[model samples]
Structures are given as structure tokens and as C-alpha cells.
Target: MKDFIKFLRLDSLCGQLVAIAVLSLAALQCVNYYAVYSIQQSYASEFLSVGHDYLASVCQALAHMSAAEREDYLASLDRSRGALAKPFRFRAAEAPEWETETDYYKSVLAREAVTEILTRAGIPPRDVRARVLYGDSPEASEPHFAGYVFPMMQMLVQDGGGSWLELVQPLSVTDRRLIWRQRIFIMAESLICFALVIIFIVRAMLPLKRLGESVERFGANPETASPLPERGNYEVREVARSFNKMLARVQRNLTERDNMLEAMGHDLRTPLARVQLRLDSIEPPELREKFAANIEEIRSIVEQGLELARSLRTSEKAVPMDAAAFAASVADDMAANGGAVTFAEAADCGEPPLVAARPTCLRRAVENLACNALKYAGGAELSVERRGESVIIRVEDRGPGIPPELLEKVFEPYFRVEGSRSRGTGGTGLGLTIARNMVLLNNGFLTLENREGGGLRALITLPALKTAKIGEIRS
Candidate 1:
């Protein structure tokens, strides 16, 4: 149930469109149903009024005839061995339910037509009674229009010829033909209305669909993503335009940083070379060695700064790669370089898990961590495993762990630990910062924590998304 509701959530444009259409259709159906009874009744009542008027005329004709002539006149209209107008007790004028105001089918039109008819015939209002009924009822007591077999009306008139008169007439105004005609009309109306509504909704939401696709494509690779079309509703077009502006700004900043790094590479290296040359001309051999070492230290710092800038301008693309193999290769490479790194694979890592990554940038991140471990702890233990939908890469070192307060601060650029991994080891201090940024670029995160015993552990958690792209953040 929750999943179904989530599917219908109005956060999406399609969901909202469907919801609105359904509600509108339901309301239309309700109104159509409610109007059915009234429309049918009104049409049938018009014919019912005609029947009453005919009955009144018959009574008026009989009143003008002498007692002897009335019998002969009535016989002239007889058919099917029955009289059309029959005599009855006028005392039952108030007995019919339809004559009462509570009658559903009774309307002002029927009443006015009947009243005018009776008055023109010189009949007192109190001397007449009229009602309409359905043919299915035993009390129909009228000549129902056999062609329709619907409801009917009854009338009783006081006769001036020493007898009471009663008349039966069919209230056959609206029949199957009329009702079916109305039905077809309503069906066509509803169909056209809903068709227009659905078409409008689809067209209106087309741009939203395009926007969603653009966002998905953008998140796949921010560096090389194409701008979304600025063709939609006002709000959607604005969003696309804003995203294009933002992407352009990011691209511009990255270009500027790269240019600065290139200029620094050329301008700073010549000065360092000139200083080394000057030291080469020193008189004492011991003094020359000391000065040369200091110069080398400065050169190393310069090189590290360049490397940090290079990390910032990294343009590596992401692709699916085996997590276990990647982690194993990083450790192997470090050990081959005499960095004292060892690799371990968890039992769960039997089948290599694939993750989206930029291999070169990701490798640099792990290398920096391993090298940092070697400086403080002399050795590093690396392990890779799969945990649910995520892959974990942990690098552990048996060194004095960083202080709790400085754990977050250690990720800041140029932040070096004060203990075993101090400045004496010669570092630019941007290792952790660069490593974390690289991990983030690959849709992963890095964290540091002290081991249960006495060591520090760097854990990299990468979500197992084969299509995950580099240099993109999920908004």
C-alpha cells in the first residue's frame, strides 16, 4: 500500500496530471447521474399535461349534452368493448397520491396546464383531482401509452349531468427514444471532455518529462553533460536555464585553476633551479651538502603543491570497475614501491563487486592514504569487502590514532598531524583532503576512525551504482 501511494505521489508531474483527470471525470459522472431523473421527468410531464387538458374537454362536452344524448355520445367513442370516459364517485378526488404536493414527478408546468384547462371548461378547482403513476404499479388505473409503458396520470371530474366522471390518460412525454438520445449525447459529451483534458495534461507535462531525463543524463557526467532544452513551461524553462548557467560557471572556475597551475609550474621551477645552482658553487663540501638538502626539501614542497592543483583539475571519467581488483592492485603497487602495504580480501569479496569510478584518480587517493600510513605506522593493512549494495575499502595502520577533536579537521587542506606523522616526514599536508575529494568525485565517501585496539583506519564506502558518474553531485 505504501509503495502504491509512493507511486502516485504528486511530487512528479505525471502523477499530478493523472490525479486531476480522474477527479474531474468522477465529478462529471456524478452530475450526469443526478440529472437523469429530472430530465426524464420533465419531458414526460409535458405529455401528462396534454392528457389532463383532453380529459377536461371531454367532461365539458358531456355537460352540454342532455341526459339521453350523453349515453349515445359516449357510445360513439367506445372501443374494445370499453368506455373511454367512465363515471365514478367524485368523493375520491383527494385519494390520489400524485395530486398531493409531495409528488416527485408533479411540476408547475403540469399543474398550470391542468388548472387552465379545467377553468376554461367552467369546472371548480375543488371538484377536480389529478395524478400520474408508473405502469408497473397495480394502481396505474389509466390508459398508459402502450408504446412506452411508462408512468401515467389519473383525473376525476364532477359532472353536471347527474354523474361523476373519471378519465385515464398516458403520460408518455419522454420514452426510450428520448432517454437513449440523451444518453448518447451525454456519452459523447463526456468522451470529448475527458479526451481534451487528457491531451492537455500530456502536452503540459511533456516538458517536465524532458527535464527529468536531462537531470538523469546530467548526473551521469557533469563534466561533459549537454545543457537541457529551455523549451517548456515558464518554471521548467527557467530551471533548465539556471542549470546551464551554473554548469558554465563551474567549467570556467576549473579552467582558471588549471591555467594558474600551469603558470606556477613554469614561473616557480626556474627560481628553484637557480638557487640549486648557486648552492653548487659553495666552497665547503659539507656546507654544500646541507644547503643542497634544504633546496631539495623546498623543491619537494613545490612539487606537492603542483600535485594538489592537478588533483583539483582532474578530468577523469567514471566507469564500472571491479572493487576487489582495484583495491588489491593499489596495495600491490604500494608494496612494489617499498611502501610496506599488505592486501586482504574478506570472504564476502568472492565475487568482485563492480562500482563506478575514475581509476587513476581513485588510485591516487588510495596511494596517498597508504603512504600516510607508512609514515606514521611503518606499515598498512588494506581490505576490501561488499556490504549489501555498497563496497567498503578499509586501510588500517597500527599507529597512534589521531585525536578525536582533530579527526574532521585532518581532512582540511594542508592539515598535518602533530605526532608520528609530523612535518619531519616531509608532506604538503593536502593528502587527506585530495583523497576525500577524489572519493567524492566517484560517488563515494571517506571516513577515519580509531580501531578497537590501537590504530587508525581509513574507510572508503562506495555505492554500487554501475552507471554512477564522476564529478557529479546528486541534488
Candidate 2:
């Protein structure tokens, strides 16, 4: 059942709509066929009812006539042409053969009606027998066309001389051509209905598809993503409008928060500077050193907090850059800043290792990782490689790795491992959080895992730009 649903693509709205339309059409066709067949049967019964008197008169004549006269009369009826000709046949037999069983209720009703007609013709009902015949019956040689079968009736009556009279007539005069025409008409109507239904469904769902795309883009980069257009039905337009309103509100809130953080940093830095200037009046050298260190820590916390806010709202445009060269530059910069960092050779690939990203933000994220590794593990090694459609930039170190349980918790804002909380470690606990945010801003992923021997590995995976060429590099 699962495989069948998958094959039909019933998980999607369009597939379900088409399936329902087809099923409804099938059911309608079945009902139409039954209705038409029932109507045809009703017409046949009415025809038999209207012709009962005429059939009784013929039976009366045959019962009284001699065998020779009856033969002449039947020959005259057969030889007559056009409107004068009767659409029935007569014959003489020694004994009558009546059908013992039949599946059609209409056939049983036809037999009973014919028996009543014979009784009215002065013939004994016990000596009269009747049966209904379809095209499949051996005694029925009725013409068939276009796979349609015709039905007929046969009746037998005993005469005074022990001879039997046989009569045959069509049950109904339905046109074979007419049945085909009706079927073709039904099929064409069903097809038109199905087409109209599909067109309406697709048009109705188009706006929803666009809305989903806009939502995904906004989630990836809300600062740059455009608002969804309010077009389509009333409900769809309303949804788009609501989403645009929410997006604007979120952007406004973010702007206000960033501005507040910037103002706080500015307001707190001036007072801290005044305090640092006044620290020399403490007299004792050790106490003076402690006061200065505490002031510096406070300054560091303010700067890191501002940095975290800024990372959330970067406006830098992304461009294609070689991932290998990018990693090399970051490693070089970190080393020049007196941090032990090494750049490893790029992995061999047929094409240039390019990725689309905001260069400044990506650099900041990688620098944060390298700096963290340097502070705790004393050194860091950076490497770049292309893995399928993604470019990986890894910063690894050889130090006591984080506890397995705290790996993900370390990425939260202001979260620190047990030993790294002291001022000597020199972290405001926002470095990893800010770094992850910066990477996410450029549609990249940042993850931390424990190294095999004893260390932590920070991996950044960015989507590789296959369309970028070496000539397109812009420093």
C-alpha cells in the first residue's frame, strides 16, 4: 500500500485531487450505465404491454386455423413489405420448449405477460408456455453490432388438433448506434469535467507554493529576503499579508535591539575608561592590578555582547570565493596575530574549491574558532576540502575536548564549560554563539565534535558554487 501511494504521489495535493476526480468519474459512469440499462428494460416492458392485444388476436386465429392455412397465413405475413409487414414470426411444432430458469427478472415478467395474452385468446393457460431469449441463446439469431446484444421473446400455444403454434418477436427495438453515441458522449463529458477540475486546483494551489518558497527564503536570511506578494484567493492573500506584517515586525524588533545594544556599549565604555584612569590611586600594586583586570573584563564583556548582536543582523552581500584560499588567509591572519595556527594543503579536486558567502562574516566565524582553539588547546590546524556539493573548513586542536553531554550546550549564548568560567581564560562565553550565528547568516553550518585522540573539531560546511570559475576570483 505504501509503495502504491508513493507511485501515485498521493502525498501531494495535486495527486490526491486527480485521484479523487478519476474515482468520481468511474462511479458516475457506473451509475449512468445502470440507469440507461434500466430505462431500456422499462421501454421493452411497455412495448410488450401495448402489443398484447395484437398478439392475442394472432394466437386466436392460429388456434382455430388448420395447419395448411396457418402456414399460408405466416407466409403472407413474411412476404408483406414495408409498413404492412409484421415484425414477428410464426411456426408449428409438436411440443413446446419453455425456459426452466433465468437470471433476468424482466424475462420472468415477460413470460407471465405472454401467458395472460394466451389465456385471453381462448387458449388454456396450462397448454401455453413462454420464454425470453437474448443474443447468447442458441434459438436466438438476432443481429448484433458494436458489442451490443439484442433481446427477444418466444411463446408456444397448443391447438385443438394437438399441434403447437410458435411465435417469436423482438423484446425491444433499441438502436445499436444510439448506445455507442451515448457512451461516447459520456466519456467526452467526463474528460471535460476532469480537465476543468485540474485547472482550478492548480490555479488555487499556485499561491501557496509561492508562499512556501518565500517562507523558506525568509527563514534562511530574513534581512535580505523580500516579502511575499499578496495575490490569489482571499484566504491566500490574507495569509501572505499576515506573513509580511510579521516579517516587518520581526525586522523592526531586531533593529531596535541592535541599536539598544550599541547604545549600551557606548554608554558603559566611557565610565569604564574613567574608572581605568582612576585605578592608579589604589596605592598597592597587587590591588591596582586586580582593579585594572576587573575593569578590562567588564570591557571585554560589553564588546563581546555588542559583537553578538551585530552578528545577528549582518547586511553583507555574498559572493563566490575560493574556499581553499579563504581558509589559508584566515589561518595566516591568526598566526600573524601571535596565535599558533597552521594551514593545511587543500584536497585535490578537478574544479576550483569555490563557495558563495559573505567574506567578512565567514572570516570572523573561522577566526573565532581558531582563537578558541588557541586559548584552550594552545594551537589550531585549519584545512579546506570539497565534499560532494559542499566545501568544508575545519579547525582542529589537540586539547581536552568538551564533555560529550555539553557539546551542543556550548553553542548557546553566554554558556561556558565548567573550567572556562574564570577571568584568566578570557572569554565572555559568547564566542561560539556569535560564530555559529555568523556562519548561519551566510547559509552555512557550524558543528563541534570530539576528536579521536583528545581534542575538539569545529567544522563549517558551505554550499559549493559549481558555477564559479578561477577567473571570477575577487581577492
Candidate 3:
């Protein structure tokens, strides 16, 4: 039962199709069975009524017969009683417990028509036995000859400890024809109903299942610009409407918030710059030196703040570039900036297998990570290599690594590991955040781990560009 429920939850197109098909087929079978049952009941009742009328006509004639004529009638009833005849030739088979031939034929004969028919047919009592084979029990009634057989049916007597009414019910050729005809009708209707159900359910559920998947994908990446087809039933349309509205709202709010933060950072920088200029002109020997140093520190703080804010705004779109050359360029740029930066090794990565990315942003991200290592750990080991379908740029330093708990949290904005009481590092605590954002924008990832030897190792892996164009870019 648990496995069956799990199968129903499978969201594949084929699975959903099968589920709908099965449900539809079952419903059709139920409806078809009920319809055929109703038809059987109507026709069976008609058959019973006809049997009763036939008995009535024969009994009426027997009532006026003389005693000698009644003896001959009884003789005829006895001879025909054992004959095999089809009672209902044109009727279809009934499904319910009461809809069978034994019920209709036996019950109708037990009515007043049987005796009247026997007498009308010149049959007398003590001539023929009234044998009723009730589905509930089976026993033959006693035979009477040359006597009033009408009283035998009403005797209420028990034979073999069970009650029975005997009548001659011979099966005719028409009975066989009706049986075959009814069977074919019921089977044909059942098959047609099954087909209709499969068709209806498959058509309806196919789109709904696809729409559910589309909603999942949209939720996974709200920035995805691929639009879903606005087609299907009302419920699907309503769901799509809600999804699109929520997506638009999220995009709008994020855009507005980023714009506000960027604007504020830009506006505040000019005032900070003006304050620095005023402090530099102060000439008090002792007071001026302290004030100038404080003003310069404020300027640096403001610059870092603005840089952090700008990095948070994810505006970089990825493009193709040479991983080896990009890594080399970063190291050389730092070397030119008077930093002791050196590349441990470099190789072509991405595609077959030159990795593609936004060259400038990736270069800046690698440089920032290297800067962090050099600032705290005093120089670093930087290496670029292909790892499966990604380019892994690793920077390992010899200085102390962050605590284990703080490793993941370091990516959060302004999450400095050092306590407030300690002398803080020069960084504004946004370098890792910027690097992570850049990696994500390039369809890559950045992870930090404690080196076995000592210090921290930052690994950046970006998707390797596998297409022909990546090779061209690398060349």
C-alpha cells in the first residue's frame, strides 16, 4: 500500500498519464455495470409477466372442462411436465441475485396462473407434479393424476422437508438467442465506456502535471525569464497567474532595494571626501595629526562600505574566457600592485576543456581571495586546474584559519569572525560575500576549508564551458 501511494506521486508525464487512465477506466466499468443491471431488471420483469399471462389463459379453459376432459388434460400436463423448454428466449441476462431465469420462471408459476393453466389445458389433479427449483433449495413435488391438481399447488405441504411448486418450463430456441445477444451488448458497452474514460482523463491531466512541474522550476529560480505557456484549465490558469504575480513583485522589490542602497552609498561618499579634505588643512601640531589620521580612517571605511554595497547588486552576466590566462592576469596585477603574489600552476580549463566566464569579474574575485590570504596569512599559494566540468581556483595560505563554525557564516554580509573587543582586521568583512556572489553569477561555487597544514584554503569552481565557442574564446 505504501509503494502504491508512492507510485501515484510520480510526477513524470508517463506516470501521470497512466494514473489518469486507470482512474477513468475504473469509473467507466462502475457506470456500465449499473446501466446494464437496470436494463436486465426491466426486461426480466416483462418476461415474468408474459409467463403469468400464459398460465392464466390455459387455467381458464380447464375450469369449464368436464370430468372426462379433465382426465385427458391431466395426461397432457404429465407428459409435458418433464420436457426441456427455454422459458425466456428474447431476454438478456440479469446480473443481480433476483434477475436470473429460475427466479422469474419459478415465482411466476407459483402464482394462481399455474393451476388455472393446467385445468384449462384439460389437466386434472393427481396428474402432474408441481416441481419448483428455488435457487435457495431443490426438491421435486409429488405427482397427482385424474384429480383436482389446483389444490396441490395451495396444499402448503412439505416434500423432502422443503416447499416447491411444479410447472412444465421448457427451454425454447429463442432463449439461447437472447442470452448471446445480451452478453454481446453488455461486453460492447463496457469496452466503449473504458475507451472514453481513458481518452478524457489523459487529455485533462497531461497539462495539469506539466503545469505543476513548471511551478516548481519557477520557484527554484525566481530570476528565470523563461515564461510558461498560459494554457490549460481554469485552475491551472489561476496558478500561473499567482506565480507570475509573485515573481514580478519579488523582482520589483529587489530592484528597488538595491537601487536605494546604491544611491545612499554614492551620496554619502562625497561628504566623507569633503571631511577628509578639511582635516588635511588643519595645522594644530598634536590635535591636527590625530584628527587627520581619524579622517583618513573614515575615508577608508566609507570606501569599503560603498564597495560592499556595489558587490551585493548582482549585475554581472557570464561570458566565455580562458581560465589559465585569467588566473595569470590576476597574479600579475597583484604583483604589479607590490603584493608578493605568485601562481603555483596554471592550465587551460573549461569546454574541451577551456572554462568560460565573465573574465573581469572572475579576475577580481580571484584577486580579492588572494588579497585576503596575503593580508592575514602573509602571501598565498594560488593554483588553477580543471576538476570534472568545472575550473577550480584554489588559494591556500599559512596563517590561522577561521573557526569551524564561522567558516560558512563568513559568506554572510559583514560577518567578521574576530570579536568586537579585539583589534579588527583591515577588511570590511564583505570580501567573501562578494566572491561568493561572483561565483554564483558565473554558475559556480566558492567554498572554504581549513588546510591540514594550517591557515585557510578557499576553492572557487566555475562551470567549464563545453561548447565550440569556449575553445574559440580560449584561443
Candidate 4:
């Protein structure tokens, strides 16, 4: 049922409006029809009563008249029939023939209304009119009779002089035509009014469209400020104000969290530095070296945690750098320092890409992967690839790979693979976590996985940008 309603467009604003308009039009038609029908019925009843009364008046006058006077009265009645009343029509019957004088009176008095009146006067019409009149010489013709009855009498007039009367009440042509025209005009006006209302609603809803756009942008890029207009209808303005307040609260909370992490990492580093100094001052040479080594490793861990916090705090204002060349230089520097790190352009590379990033932060990320590989895998191969809208810097090695189950655990602070955090390995176990935090702060992602045959592969993907045109490059 929900799907059917969707297909019928019932959920949309425009569809609801059209449905309301249709129901209103149907209601209007019913009301118009009933009102017109009631008025016509009333007019018909009144006209019918008036016609019956007029018929009776004419019948009474004919009954009291002499033969010569009756002929004159019939002619006058026929003439006056045209003008009897408004919205009524009348017609007189033709003359009749009889074989005898008594037959004429009998036929005349035997008509429905005439017999009724004569019977009341103690006369039987059938006894008087006994003969049949064959009017034509060869062809037989039906006899005609005349009678008068008023509108109220509801009876007929019968006589040889003027026989049949027709009284009719028909709807006026002018009134009927006007009624039809009015219905047509109402329909036309309704359609036009409905169209106007729809247009007004759409225009009024424009502000809501803009508010929706603002909401989507706020969700998409929370770090950027987009102030919503506190204007338009009351509901719209209220929504805008609420959205702005929410954005402000989210930004403040995030900022405060980053600051707290930075402060804790900074305060811890001072004590760690003091401990490293004390370890160096131990009396026994071999024991002092071992103790010094332990304290320095602890200090390195502290520094890496501080770096991660700082990366998050500074990424929003980080300076831009050429990401491709920067990655290559880090690899070359590690190799020069006696680490087995090799740098090469990818087969699918283009001119170096630029990125909105901190050079020091990005360099630290690539350096951490190289050092991790040199420590465990003995060497690593580094390359930069330019993908659509992104730069992918990969560091791959050939050594015992990290266990599949522990792949994600390696990036957690102070986490190391089982048996890989030995003092002989000389690692603080915070390198990969720091690298990942830096990558994330720069609006990128860093992934770690085993290469096809053996060893770990770390790939950092950053949003790609075009290299600056000549003068646009910063020194």
C-alpha cells in the first residue's frame, strides 16, 4: 500500500494539493446540481396549480353561454390562451360533428370535466349523446370535443364547439441556457483558482529548499563555517537558528577534546625527558646503557603520542606541499641514512601533485612506515602513484608479514605485533599509530596490509591537486 501511494504521488506536496482541489470540485458540482433541481421542482409545482385554475374558469364561462355566445367565447378563449400567464402554453381542440341535435348535446356533456359538472347538476351525459357522427364522406374522422376547467378544478371541458385543450408547463429556454453557462463558468474559475494556489505554494516553499541545502552542507563539511540565514517564515528561521547552534556546539567540543589530548601529551613528555636524563647518569656502564636504552624508548613513545595530538590540532591550518616529491625525498633520506629504503616514480605517475598539508607531518608518516619495514622486513620499496583526484604513496617490503587478525590492532597506541616489541628491535611501538593520525588529520587515509607474497604494505592516499603553475609555487 505504501508503494502504491508513492506511485500515485500522494506523498508529495503538489499531489496533496491536486487531491484537495479535485474533491472540492466534486462537492461544488453536487451542491450546484441539488440547488438547481430543487428550484426547478418548486417552479414546476406552482406553474401546474395556476394552469389548473385557468382551465376551470374557462369551463364555467362556456357552460352559462348561449349557442351563438359559446361560439364567440371559444374564439375569444383561443385568442386569450396565448396571453393567459407567464411560463405556460395552451391549445384548443378542433370542432366535432353529430347526426342529431340531441347527439350533439350528449357528446358535448359526456366529456370528462363536462360530465362531472353536469352529473353534479343531475344530468347524465351518456343518455343525451346517443348518435355517432361520420364527419367525412369516404374516410372516417375521429370526433373532437371542447371543455373548460380552471387550474384549481383539475378537470376537463367537453362541447361540440371547441373540444380538446392542451396546457403545458415547460422550462424557460433562457433560464436553462443561463444555468448551463453558470456551471461552465464555475468550473473554469475553479481551475484557474487551483492553478494560482499551487503556484503560490511553490513560491512560498523556496526558502525551505535553501534550508535543506544548508543542512546537507553542514553535515558534509563540519569544519568549515556556513552561517544559515535567520530569516523567512518563523518555522524556517527557527530551524536555521537551531542548526547554527548545533554546529557551534560540535565545533567547540571537538576543539576542546583536541586541546586536552595535546596538554596531557605535552605534560607527560617533560617527566619522561627528566627520566631519560636520570637513566644516563647510572653508575655501572653496561647496566646504565641498558637503562638508558629503556628510558629513551619510553621518551620516543611519549614524543610520538604528542606528535599525534599536535597533528590533529594543526591540520586545519597546515601549510601546503608537493606531496609526490616530498614522499620521494623522505624515502631517499632514509636510504642515505643506511636504511634499505628505495624510491621510484610509479609507472602511472604524472607531474608531481600538490596537497593542502603540513610537510613535516606528511614526511613523518612516510618515514614511520620506512623505519617499521627496515626494522622487521630488512628493506622496503617506496613509490608514488597519481590516481584520479588522489595521490597514493605506497611503501612495500619483503619480510614476515603481520598476522591477519592483528592488522588493525597495530595502529592502536603502544600496540605491537606479538614478539615484535623486543628491545633488540629498538621500536617504541607508537610509529604506525602516529602515522595514521597524521594522515587522517590531513584529510586522507592510511591503510596497512600484507603484500601479495610476503611482508607489510602501507599506502597513504591523499586528495590530489594540480601542481602550481610556475609563479604559484612557494619556494
Q: State which candidate has the highest TM-score.
A: 2
* TM-score (all chains, Cα) for each model: 0.60, 0.68, 0.52, 0.47
C-alpha positional error of residue 276 in candidate 3 after TM-score superposition, expressed in Å = 1.9
Model 3, 1-475: lDDT tens digits are: 5533443465755457666666766687667667656666566545545655554443444456675675566466555642533332111111212211333444345444445555555645422223334223322332322222211121111112122223333222234466668668767866776666555655665566566666674453344334556567787677767766776787677667767766877787788778767875777768878877676666666666666655544555556766766777788888888887787765443233357676666776787899888888778777878777677888888888888888898987767778531225666677888787666556567899999978899998877776766556556
TM-score of structure candidate 1: 0.60
User: C-alpha displacement of 116 in model 4, angstroms?
Assistant: 34
lDDT by residue for model 1 (333-414), tens: 8889888899986786444577877899889888889888898889999988788679888999999999989888998877
Stronger candidate by lDDT (2 vs 4): 2
Tell me the RMSD of model 3 versus the true structure: 10.8
The lDDT of each candidate is 0.71, 0.78, 0.60, 0.64
Candidates by TM-score, descending order: 2, 1, 3, 4
Candidate 3 to truth, TM: 0.52
**TM-score, cand. 4 vs. native:** 0.47
lDDT of 2: 0.78
* Rank order (by lDDT, best first): 2, 1, 4, 3
Query: Which of 1 and 4 is ahead in lDDT?
Result: 1
| Candidate with the larger lDDT of 3 and 4 | 4
lDDT of 4 by residue, 324-438 (tens): 6787788878878999888877674555666777677778788888888888888988988878778888999887888888888888777766676554576666788878867
Lowest-sum lDDT 10-residue window in model 4? 146-155
lDDT of 2 by residue, 1-475 (tens): 6633443477777578778877887799889878877877677667666555555666677777887987787566545522343445555555855552367665566557767777766686546556676777765453421222346566666666676666666676555687778778778887898778767776777787788878887886576557888999999999999999999998888789889998999899999999998998997999999999889889999999889889987778888888889899888887888989999997578877789899999999999999889988999999998988898999999978899998899998888887754346888789999898888887887999999999999999998887734346444
